[model samples]
Target: MSMTLRKRAVLAAGGLALVAALAWAFSPRPLAVQTAAVTRGLYEQAIEEDGRTRLRERWVLSAPVAGRLQRITLREGDAVAEGDTVAWLQPGAAPLLDARTERQNRAQREAAAAAVQRALATEAQARTAREQAELAERRSAQLAAQGFVSATQRDADRLNTHAARQGLEAASAAVRMAREDLVRAEAALAPPAAALPLSRAGGQAPLRLRAPHGGQVLAVPLTSETSVAAGTALLEIGDLRQLEVVAELLTADAVQARAGAPVQIDRWGGETPLRGRVRRVEPAGYTKVSALGVEEQRVKVLIDIDPDQPAAAALGDGWRVGLRILTLRQTDALQLPVAALFPRPDAPDPQGRAMAVYTVDAEGHARLRPVTLGGRNGQQAWLRDGLAAGATVIVYPPAGLTEGARVQARTP
Candidate 1:
C-alpha cells in the first residue's frame, strides 16, 4: 500500500474512535446537580432520629404489700409528690399473694426482729463467759505452778477457756447473720416501682401499683372492673417535670456514639424542632431483625433536653419526639451534598489523607478534584480542602464521562 493511503486510513480510524467516545459521554443518566455556595453558616453533623418522650425522673407505683385495687384516688395524669397516698388496695388479692401470704410477710418481719434480739443476747452471754473463763485460766496456771491445783485441773481450765472463745466467735457470727436476714426480709416486703409484672401475659395482680418516685400517672392499666390474673397490670406512674429523649439506634450507629454529641428532637404534632445533648449510650446491645430478616444489634441512646429552650416545658415523660444527634459540626466550611460529589476510583495516591471528587469547570468537563473531607452530617459533608467556594460540580454525570469528558450543564 502507498504511504499516503496508509496515513489517511489511520486518520479515518482515529476519527471514528473519537466520535464513539463522544457519543458514550453524551448519553443521559440520572444525576443530581448542586452548587457549592460560599456562605457564613454553621454546619451541624447530627444523628437524626424519631423517638418517644419521657420524664427525666419517673417512677412506677406498685403495691408494697399484696392487696387488690381497692380504690385509686388519683387518675392517670394526676400530679403526685413524695409521701402522697395515691391508692388504697383491698386487704387481699395480689398476684402471688393471699391473705396467708400477707400475714406471713408481717410475721416474718416480726420474727426477724425477734431473732436479731436473740442473737444480741446470745452474743452478750458468750462475751461474759469468755471473760470469766480467761480469768479462771490465769488463776489455774498460777495454782498449778504453786502445786495447789492438779495438772489435770489446770488442763481442764485451759479447755474451758478454748470452748468459751469458740462460743463467742459463733455468737458474733450469728448476730451478723441475723442482721443480714432482717435486711433481706425488709427488701422482700418492699415493692419495686415497676415490679416485674406478676405475669408477662396477665401483669401484676392488683396490689396497688404505687408511684416509685414523685411523678405523673402515665397509664391506668386497670380502669374497668374486670377479673385480672395474678400478673395483671394496675397502673403506671411517672414524673414529667424531668424529661429526656430516647432513641433506638442500630448497633453501628451506637458504636460511634460519644458523650457530648449534640442531638435535635422533633415532638409529635410539634411545629419546631428542639436541640439536645447525648447524655448516655447504653453499653449493651439488643437483638433486632431488619426488614430483610437479617439479624442486627441495636442500642438505646439517651439525649438530654436543654432546659433553657422554651419547648422543654411542653415535653413530658413517654412523649414521642424526633431527634437529630450532632456527631460533628463545622463552622465556615466548604459544604457539599453527597449527591453532588464523586469519588475517582482510579486516582493515584498522593500524600497522606486525600480523597477525590468530580467538579465541573467553566468548559463543562468533569475535572478530577482532590479534596479533603473533614466532617459530615446526614446529607451534606464539610469540605476542608481541594474544593473552593462557588464551584459547580456534576452530581451524577453522563455515562463514559472521563476527567476531560464534555458535559453540558443543565440550565438551573
Candidate 2:
C-alpha cells in the first residue's frame, strides 16, 4: 500500500514539472528595445539654412556721358579714396554728316536764322507800341492835373502805360533769345576739329572721373580703353567693412524669424561660429525649385555680423556660410528624443493632438503614452504633458511593439 501511493505522487510531480518547462519555453520573452530618458534641459527651436556674405551697399560707376573711356589700371579689391581720379574720358566728336545730312543741317540753320529775324520784327512792333503807350500816359498825367479828364480815366491810362512797358521788356527778352539761337546755329557749322579744344586753355583735355566714395574696387567690367555710351556700367565699388549676410529660408521658417534675433554663423571656413543678428526678414517671397524638383517658397533674410568680432574681418563679399537662426528657446524643459514619438492615426485624439510614445513602465513593459507635443527639432522634442522627467521612453519603437508589451532595455 505505501509503494503504490509513493509512485502515484512521483508521477503527478513529474507531469507538473513538464507542463511548467513547456510554458517557460513557449511564453513570449521581453522585447529588447532602445530607450531614452525624458530629461529637463535647454531646448531651442531654430531654422538652419545656407547663406552668403555680401556688402550692404554696392556702387556701380557708369559713364556720365558718351565718350572714350581710358584704360582702367585699378584691379579688383584695390583701395580707392574719395576724389581720386579713377579714370579719364574724352568727349566723343560729333558724327560725320553725309551729303543729305549736311544739306539738312544747312536748311535748319537757315530756318533758325529766319526765326531770329521774325522774333526781331515782333520785338520792334512791341517797342513801337510801348513808346506810344508811354507818350499817351504822359499826356494823360497832364490832362488829369488840368482836370480835363476824370481821375478814373487818368488811372486807366497809367495802367495801360505800365502794361506797355512790360510788353517792351518781354520783346527785349525775345530779342536776346533770338540772338543766342543764331549764335548756336552758327557754332554748329564749325568742324569737329574746331570743337576738340573743350578747355579754357584752348587745348584738348580729357575729363577726369573721380570716385565719389572711399572704398575698394569691387569689379572692373572693362580694363582696356573703349568707347562707352552714357549710363553704361563701368566698375563696381563697395566697402568691405559694410557687410551683411543673406540667407534664403523657407517661407514658413522665415516668418518665425524676428528682427534682431540671434544667429549662429558656421561652416564658413572658420574655426569658431561667428555671432550675427537678423537685420531683416524680407517682405517678399519667391518661388524656388529645389534639387528634388519641388517648388518651394523662399524668403530672404539679412543678417548683420557684429563688426567688433575679430572673425568678421576675415569674411568677404559672396562667401558661403551656414546659418542657424534661433527663433525660440526654453530653459529647463521636459524633453525626450524625437525618435520616441509616433503618430496615432488609428485612434486620433479629438483635439487632433494624437502624438504618442512608448514609455517603459515600472514593470519593464512598454506602455503607450499620449503626449502633448510642443517645440521640436531634428533630434529632440519638448513635451508639454503626459511624461515626467526621468521616465524612460522606447526610441524608434518597432511596428510590432504595442501597448502593454513587455520590453527590456538594450545594452549599449
Candidate 3:
C-alpha cells in the first residue's frame, strides 16, 4: 500500500467514527426514575402554619361610675352571678355651689318664673284684645254690606282681624320661651349624678367593678388602696367550664377551611388529641409582617371544641394549639403526586392547565399521554376523571428524555 492511500483511509475511518458518536449522544436512552404505586393514602394539598390557642370569649368588667368601694365580698377566682353584689360603691358627689352661688341661682330661677308669669298675663291680655278686634271687624263688615260704611271699611276690618291673629301667635311663643328658660335654670341648679365607682385612674376611692357575665373571676387587679378611673379594667371573668380554641391562619389557608369541616387539634401539650369542627373563618384579614419581613395577610379561624373531649379539659386560656384544616376527604379514592407529571417535548403547544405525563408503554418505549387532573393540595393531586388506578405511574422524570423515546424503568 502507498503512503498517500494509507493516509486517506485513516481520515475516512476517523470521520465515520465521529458521525456514529454524535448520533449516539443525540439519541434517546433509558432514563432513571422512581416509581410510585397508585394506592390509596391520605392526600393533603394545603399550606401549614403555626396556630395559636386563645380563649373562646374574654369578658373584662369595668366600673360603672366613680366612687368609693363600699362593699366587696368576692375575691379573685370567685364565681359570681348576674346582678351579684361584687362591689358596693359610695359614689363621689358633685361639687356643691356656695351659698352666694346658690342664692344667685335661686334669684335667676325666680326671675325666670316671674318672666313666665308676665308672659301668661300678656297672653291673656292679647286674647281679650283679639276678641274685641273680632267683634269690631264683624260690625264693620255688616255695616259695609248695608251701605252704611264704604267697601274699603270692610277690608280695613279684615286687616285688623288678621293683625289680631298674629298678635295671639306671638304671645303664645313668648310664653313658651319663658317657661323653657325657667326649666333650664332649675335643671342647672340640680345636683350631678353619681360618679363611676371604678375608674381607670387609680385614686384613693377606687371605682366599683363587677363581672358582666356569670363566670369565674380570672383576674382582679383592683386592691384596697388601688384607684381606678372611668372605663378602667378592674377584673376579668370567663366561663372556664365552657372553653374553645381560636387560631389564626394565613388568609390563603383559611379559604380551604369550610364551615362544619372536621378539625384534628393535636400537639396541645395535653394527654390526648381533641377533635373540633370549623366554626367560623374570619371574613377579614389583618396585615401582619412576619419575622422574615414577609408582609402577609392573616385571618383567624375559630374551631369549636367539644368540651367533653380530653384536650378541652386540659386546655386553658392562651395554650398553643395546632389545627389540621381538612380540605377534602374521601375513602378508596385514586390520587397521585403532581410531581409525577412531565411535559412532552413533542406536545402540540403549551397551555398552563394541561398536564402531560410520559408513561412507559408495553413495548418498553416512552409514550407521552395527556391526563386530566382535579383539585390538589400541598403534596397530592386528585385523579378526577382520568388515569385508572392499579396502573404504574412514573414520578420525577430525568432530563433529556422525549416522547416515544426508547427507555426502560431501571427500578422494574
Prediction 1 global C-alpha lDDT? 0.66
Q: C-alpha displacement of 284 in model 1, angstroms?
A: 1.3
Each prediction's whole-model lDDT (CA): 0.66, 0.82, 0.67
lDDT of 3 at 247: 70
TM-score of 2: 0.70
Model 1, TM vs. native: 0.58
Alpha carbon deviation, residue 96, candidate 2 (Å): 11
Model 2, span 323-378: residue lDDT tens:
99998899999999989988876777665456889999899988988888777888
Give the number of the best model, judged by TM-score: 2
Which scores higher on lDDT, 2 or 3? 2
TM-score of each: 0.58, 0.70, 0.56
| Stretches > 4 Å off in candidate 2 | 1-20, 94-202, 345-354
Q: Scored by Cα lDDT, where does model 3 land?
A: 0.67
In model 1, which runs have C-alpha deviations exceeding 4 angstroms? Answer: 1-41, 56-58, 63-69, 90-213, 224-235, 347-354, 362-365
What shift in Å separates residue 231 of candidate 2 from its native position after superposition? 2.7
What are the runs in model 3 whose C-alpha is more than 4 Å off?
1-29, 40-47, 64-94, 97-210, 249-253, 343-353, 362-365, 405-412
Clashes of 3: 20
